[model samples]
Target: IALNAWQDTPLYNDKERAALALCEKLTLSQNIDDDFYLVLAELFDQPSLVTLTVAINAINSWNRMVKMFKPTVEFNER
Candidate 1:
């Protein structure tokens, strides 16, 4: 409800809102409380899970690699 109550407009749909709410409710259930898991679930709920899953897998691999060695992302280019 916090997100809904915020000043900014809601940029999320019902499914996304539901997932966000479910993530925060922490209702004695699966590990949907995690944003990563919830986002993953929402992403999987899409028709093309295969494509996104592949991307997710790649991102997971990249994240693991980056975590192993603190990657210094350059955002200073102006």
Candidate 2:
């Protein structure tokens, strides 16, 4: 999928690439350098950046919970 190989593919624009790069860094618990902060700031305002960080953290929390609990879902036919 394009998302799975976003780095190798050319499907994303500058903003998308920036957001994806931030997401990868946050998800992997990597250090965000000053240059990377400048890149993100160029693409997004403070509020937008905060929102994106919150969203990324929320998703990562959910993923961790799922991996730990291994919850299963079921569907019922009406």
Candidate 3:
């Protein structure tokens, strides 16, 4: 709920907001401009930034796989 309205809510700090913005842009295939990069750099160090990018990409890839495969789960009664 709060996350759905992240921009409006005050629950997130600057770093979280920046990360969320990056996630949204990456997920939506939107362009990440130089200014946004600067914002991210200011908020995170180089290694941290690389890790965040990798994590976001990994999640996106997993989402794509799930959508394409539509894997099912089966449960057994005890």
Q: Relative to the true structure, how large is the alpha-carbon lDDT of every model?
A: 0.56, 0.96, 0.97
> Highest lDDT: which candidate?
3
Best by TM-score: 2
Instruction: Name the weakest run of 10 consecutive residues (lDDT summed) in model 1.
Output: 23-32
Query: Model 1: which residue pairs collide?
Result: none
Stretch of 10 with least lDDT, candidate 2: 1-10
lDDT score at residue 38, model 1, on the 0-100 scale: 58
Q: Write the per-residue lDDT of candidate 3 for residues 1-78, one digit (tens) a residue.
A: 599999999999999999999999999999999999999999999999999999999999999999999999799989
Candidate 3 to truth, TM:
0.89
How accurate locally is residue 7 in candidate 2, as Cα lDDT from 0 to 100? Answer: 92
lDDT of 3 at 47: 100
Taking all chains together, each candidate's TM-score versus the true structure is 0.39, 0.92, 0.89
RMSD of 2: 1.6
By lDDT, rank the candidates, best first: 3, 2, 1
Error of 1 at 14 (Å): 5.1
Error of 1 at 58 (Å): 1.1
Off by over 4 Å in 3: 74-78
- Those runs of model 1 whose alpha carbons end farther than 4 Å from true positions after fitting are 1-11, 14-47
Task: Put the candidates in TM-score order, highest first.
Answer: 2, 3, 1
Clashing pairs in 2: none
